[model samples]
Structures are given as C-alpha cells and as structure tokens.
Target: MKEYLKASSLDEALNLLSKDSQLKVLAGGTDLMVQKHAGSLSDVRFLDINALPSLKNINEKDWGIAIGALTTYRQILNSDLVLAEFPLLAQAARETASVAIQNRGTLGGNIVNASPAGDSLPVLLVYNALLELQTQKEKRNIAYTDFHQGYKKMDLRSGELLTQILLPKGNTWDRSYFKKVGTRKAQSISKVVMAALLKMNGETIEDVRIALGSIAAFPLRCRFLEDFLKGQQLPLLKREELDRLIEQNICPMDDIRSTKEYRLQIVKNLVWDFLKA
Candidate 1:
C-alpha cells in the first residue's frame, strides 16, 4: 500500500476522500485485505473508516429500516428488527460465509465490492433497497437497483461514500422466496441465486418482484418477468411461457462453477417451485 490512514470520524473520512481520488475506503478488510495480499491493491492508498462510530448503526425509520454501511452480516443476523421485518435479508446474511466471516464482513463492504455472486444483492433488489451516499459537502440517496451499472462497476462517485441502506417495509407479501445454488450450501460462492416477492389476489398475481445473481454481468432484477407475471393466474401460468420469460430475462455464462445451460435450467426450476408453493 502506498499509504494507510485510519479515520476517527465521518467528516475526516469524507475530507480525506475528497482529497485523494485514488484513496480506497477500507471497512471490514475482508475483500480489501484479500486484494492487498494478492498484490491487486499494491499501489492503492487506503483510508480506514472502521473507527467511525456513526457508520455502524441500525435504526427504524417511519417508512422503513435504515442500516448503516458498516453493519456486519453477524449484526444483521442478530438484529431483531432485521429478523422480524426483513427475514429474507437475515436469511441471506445467515448464508453468507462462516461465522467468523459473518462477524467481520460488513454489508457496506459487500455492496461496494459489487460481485454478481454476492448473496445479499438479490435480496436487496427484491426488497427495493435504497442507498444513502455522503460526501464532505453533501448527501444523496439512490435506489439500490440503479447502483450497479455493470460487473465491478457502480454509480458511486469519486468523493462519496455509501452511508446507509434503506429498505422499505413490506407487510403484505403473500409469499417470499430466496434460494442460492452452489457446490456446497453454506460456504461456497453461488452459481445462481434468486429472490422473489409475490402478492397474490386469490389465484391471481397482484404484484411480483424477482432478482437474480450470477446469471448476468451483475445482479439484476427481472423486470420483464415481473411485468409478465403481474395479473397472471398462478395455476394457469404456462411452463413454456415462464421458461421463455426467464430465458429472455437472464444472460447466464459458462463459468468455472457451472455451465450457462445449467444455471438457466436451475433458475427456471427454482422460480417454478416458488410459484407452485
């Protein structure tokens, strides 16, 4: 590392970020340290914000819940508010690495890392999470869906830091489903991950949101599928139509973990199972 600096406060961190465009913010060090050791970050300057107390809180807002960026996976799993109101997120957090990694890997780190295989990302998409970004001079909020532009790319600006994630409350979902497919269930990275929220009116679908990861360049919401599924009767939903929609919605690739054909088939099966249940 060219430089390593620890920030004691949010203001100082923002100020430092404003000065050095190349300065990388280090939170949990889970991803950063790995990169550092791999020599990928050899010349990067690091600004450690682990000591900033303001970025490590979770609070309930009138509209929803506000989770600080520095909140760890363990913290999310332990949070009663999170568990009760957003169990899908809690489930994702629980399925994240082992206990030690969960304790040390912060949600902020996960979001900023922008890996398509990230466990929480599909859940965040289905939940319609919002992000709050801060700079020395200003603060702004953006929809989490719009945050990722491509693989390993984001809408985050040079001097801004992601501060909080806002998740709107959903008390009316008839059913919610989250599933991750990997070599091993607990510790392995996902080959395909899917999360969906559905609201049913008797047998007809009133509303639906679906998101998927590791089937595209970045984790993405299945907007076309959601639009098609809305107002469709579940029992009458044709498997051919569903398969077509699913294929149109995702762009899976043959990778080291799994083949594109397998990922496509698994996601279709998962969605079918969720709908049937």
Candidate 2:
C-alpha cells in the first residue's frame, strides 16, 4: 500500500516534505501519478496540492501576470485577458496535450516535470516567467532558465514548492506565433516545437525571441538568435543564412521524436518562414 496525504495549506505541504525525504508533490496528478503507476517512479508519501487553493489563480499585477502553480492549461487557454494580452502564451496553451490533459495538467507540474515535450515550456521561456518557490525557511524567485536544471531535474528543494509563475508585463505584441510538430494534432506530445516573438520595422526585424523544445536537455530561449536579429534586414537572411543561423544557435539531438538533422532543418525553415510571414 502507498501512503498519501492531502495538504490543505502551503505550510502543511512544506512541513510534510520536511519530514519525509521520499515524499512526492502531486498537483494535478497528470505526470506524477502516471509515472508512479507505470513503475517509472514511486514514493513513500504523496502530497496533493489541489487542496491548497492559494496556489491556483492567474493574478494580474501592475508588474505582470502571476500564474498560480495549480492553474490548469484549460484555464490559460480560456482566459480572455491572457488571449488579449499575451497571445504567445495563449498560443502555446493551445498546443498543450489535449482537452483531457489541458483540463487536469498544471503549470507548476509542467515545469517540475521538466519534460522535453512540454508545449508551454518554450512559451514561458520567451516571456521570461519567474518561478516563485517557497519553503519553511524563506521564499525565492528564480528565472525560468535557472529553475529547469535538466531532464526531470529542477532547482526546487525538497521542502520548496513552486508557488507561482510570474510572467513579466506583456512582452508579446502583434507578431508572435507558436508552431508544433506532433504525430497527430489532437492528443500527441510535441515531436519538436518552436516559438518566435518578433517586432519588425518594415523589412528589418527590430527585436525578437526564439525558443525551441525537444531540441535540448531543457527547453531554452535563443539569446544568440535574438541578439543577431536586432535591426537585421529580413531580405538579407535567405535559406543559407537562416540555416547557418539555426546551425550556429541550436544544438539539437536525435531522440525518439526526431533526427538531429531534421530538427536543424526545421528550425532553419521555421525561422525563415515565420519571419517572412
């Protein structure tokens, strides 16, 4: 038999974790429960985060939109404020697993799960979402890049629960889109996904953020590409330049989802096509 607990408060959750080294945090149970049932991971204790409603809202502040840890994918997609303001976020939320997954999967769990195929990861990366973590000792805010350490690994400590994802005040503007490649559209994991944020001045790109998923150990923003694109004339970057830009930036791998060569080619093509569009 397995031991489980439903903690109704953040303090209770942290206290429980402080006492048990093998305890697992269960928010939506979309990832942890499946992994446990599949025998990929197991725990002596389980702390269900749903009871802590304090962790379940999308708060709009003057600084930014604070996405609660327990906020579901569906909530994000359904938010008119989100759709109106951060279309990039809404765009990525649209690509998440399916209606079923979207209904149950949580934003915090997605970050903690650290899956390479997570659709929202690339979007959050582009928006510069800040990870809010809390424990009995103190609370801290970590940048998204710093929070995701590696595959299934994060900077979160045992007693430190992810409280919220604070997205900086609307960076998304008129030109931004999320593109995903999966086996099939409805309920498939991303084979490879990419997102771009562009501010163009006629034919020249003034600023942008490029992020890709399933291409590295952790999804990351393409600072190199963003830096290179600032005020660059679009017409100058043809197929070869686009290819070289991708080749110079992303270091993709040949995983079960795709070949390294294919990923490279796709990144190059997406950059060129999206910029042109």
Candidate 3:
C-alpha cells in the first residue's frame, strides 16, 4: 500500500528521512505529482515538507544570497535583489513555465529533479551556485557543478535534503546573455539553453564564463572555450577556434525533443553570435 506522511517541522522531516530511506520528498510537487499520476511511481512513500516554514526564505548575506530551497519561482521573480544582482537567474526563472507553474514550482524541486534541460541550471553554473544539504546529524555544502554525477543522478545521500542554494556575488560583467530554445516561448521544455557572462576590457575579452544545458548529461560549463577566449580580442576571434573547443566540451544525443546535430549547431551559433554582438 502507498503511504503518505506530513512533516510538521524541519526536525520531524529530518527524523522521517533518517528512518525511512524510501520516502520521496514532496515539496511543490510540480514534477513528482505528474510522475505519480502517469503511474511512473509505484508502491512509494511520500514525505510532505510543505509545512516546514523555515525552508521558505530568501536572505541576503555579505558574500552572496542564500535562497531557501522551498522558495517558489514566483518569489524569485518578485525579488528586487535577484533582479538587480542575479538577473540571469531571474530571467531563467521567468522563462521556466507559465505563471501558474511558477507559483507552485520551487527552485529546490528543479535542482533535485536533475533534468539536463532544466532552465535554471545553466544560470546556476555561470553564477557558481553552492547547494546546502542537510540531515539530522549534519549539514554540508556542495558546488552545483559537482552535485550531478550523471544523468538523473546526484551526489545527495539517502537522508540528506537540499535546503538552500547559495549564489556568490558575481564580479562586474560587461555583458550577460541568457537564451532558452523550446518548442514554444514559455511552458515548454528546452531543446537547448545557454547562459554567459563576459567581462570585457575595451575590445579584449578579460574574462568569460559560458554554460549550456540539454546538450550534456548535466548542465555544463564551457571551460575550454572560456580559457581560449580570455585575453583574445573579440573582433579577431575566429569561429573555427570556438567550434573546436565547443566540440570537446559537450556530447549531445538524439532525443525526442531535438536531434544531436541540431543541438550542437545551435550551441555553436549561439556562442558565436554572443561574442560577435
């Protein structure tokens, strides 16, 4: 028989998790409920953590911002701090889904879902997001880049819950770009997504960070390309050099949403266009 439990407090939730490793956490339920309804989930136990108010806050720190895992996309869209400081993340949040989904979908759910096509992930990668995981015994932080070990897998332990996403204050970036290519403009899964931050010194590229999703097992940072572009004059940078580096970074596959060829070409074109502009 399927069992459901509601956690009255954070302590209660952690206790339940420590005891029952099989309990699937239920937060916003945007993805989980859909899976359950489609019969993908069977003979499962659910731990509803919606009652834990402590997990639903957005706080500013001297170093960066600590976003509670339970903070909904709606809250993110409405936060001025996010808009002014982390506009790339805010733009991704705005493009996540329709208003109704944004109201109910939590950032934590998106992270834990571990979809390669997740819209916010590339933005997080570019920002160098830190994730805080907690259990009854201890708490630890992990870099977002290292959290995903493979497709549909993460570094989370059995009893740990992702509690917060910490984003460090970004350096002064002269240019920022974010784009999500989906079947439709909104409420559609992305076929390919890219986010980039560039610090320019006159015409020379001082520093750059480029990240992409839906083209790899997990969201990827284009470190090879970033390293190649640094100190290169944008006007003189050649597409051939970029194409070579990008090819080394991602391994795309044919999926229902898009073909491998299309995804690869799109990413190359996006990067070229961003630099040229």
List per-prediction Cα lDDT, in the order shown.
0.91, 0.82, 0.91
TM of each candidate vs. truth: 0.97, 0.94, 0.96
Model 2 error, position 241 (Å): 0.9
Lowest lDDT 10-residue stretch of candidate 1: 245-254
Candidate 2 collision pairs: none
How many residue pairs collide in each prediction?
0, 0, 0
Measured on C-alpha atoms, candidate 3 has an lDDT of 0.91
Across 129-159, the per-residue lDDT of candidate 3 in tens digits comes to: 9999999999999999999888989999998
Ranked by lDDT, the better of candidates 2 and 3 is: 3
Off by over 4 Å in 1: none
Pairs of residues clashing in candidate 3: none
How displaced is residue 234 in candidate 3, in Å?
Answer: 1.1
Candidate 1: C-alpha RMSD to true structure equals 1.3
